[model samples]
Every structure is written in structure tokens, then in C-alpha cells.
Target: MGLLWGLIIGGLAGWIAGNLTRGGGFGLLGNIIVGLVGGFLGGVLFRLLGLAATGMIGSLVMSVIGAVLLIFIVGKIKGRR
Candidate 1:
């Protein structure tokens, strides 16, 4: 199912983003939230560029990009504290 794939890819992307940005992850809830947002952001970006993602690899790549962006934003916000 699409939902299943989304959860898996999003979790991976979020984990990767957190690790890369903060040297750690924000736990299960954080990862899920970031991942869900990342998936939506990825889809939006792809659409904005007049492109479409295809297959597992493409989706994963997009998710990673979105996750990276999300993590960067979150890191910046957290750093302000």
C-alpha cells in the first residue's frame, strides 16, 4: 500500500536528516512527523518543478531531499534557543 511505503520511506528520510543535522534523531514521534511533512514537501516540490516521481527510488530520493530541508529548518530554529 501507498501508506505503508510512505511511512517506511519517510521514517528513513527523517532518520537520515536528523542524524545529518543534529547527530541524532528526535525519537519516534519526531521522526514520524518530520517524515510525513517531508513526504508532502517532496510531492509538492516535484509538482512545482513540473516533474513526477516514479518508482521506489525516485520517491525515496524526493523524500530525502525534503527531509534534509526540513531538518535544516528545524535545526536552525532549535539553534536559536
Candidate 2:
């Protein structure tokens, strides 16, 4: 199904993003969670900005970017503690 593919792709994207950004901080489940949420966030962000992703690759790219951004923000907040 579409949702299944989305999860798989999102997971992969998230894993890649994590590795690239922070040497892979979150575990598998965490990455997938971040991916899915990131996908939603990316879509919403694009829409609000009057932009659109082109295809699966584009979506994944945007999602990964969002996930990395989210992780960075989390890291910043956590570092203060």
C-alpha cells in the first residue's frame, strides 16, 4: 500500500539524514517516527510557502531536511540541560 511505501521510504530517508547530520543519534524506531513527522511537516511547510515537491525523491529529500532540522532543534534544547 501507499502508506507502507511511505513509511519505508521515510525510514530510509530519516536514517540517512541522521547519519549525515549527527552521526546517527536516534534508533530505528525513532528515525521512522522522525521521518513520518518530518514528512508531514515538510508537506505543510511547502504548502504554506506556496511550493510543491516534485515526486517521491523530492518528498523524501524534503522530509530528510525537515527531520535533520528537527533533530538539530532538539539537540539545541537538550544541550541546555
Runs with alpha carbons beyond 4 Å of true place in candidate 2: none
Model 1 residue 50 lDDT?
A: 97
User: What C-alpha lDDT do the candidate models reach, one value each?
Assistant: 0.80, 0.82
Compose the digit string of candidate 1's lDDT tens values, residues 1-81.
988887887787778778877798768778767877987888898899998888978887787778778777777998899
For residue 57, model 1's alpha carbon misses the true position, in angstroms, by: 1.5
What residue runs in model 1 are displaced by over 4 Å at the alpha carbon? 78-81
All candidates: CA RMSD (Å): 1.9, 1.5
Q: What C-alpha lDDT does candidate 2 achieve relative to the native structure?
A: 0.82
Best by lDDT: 2
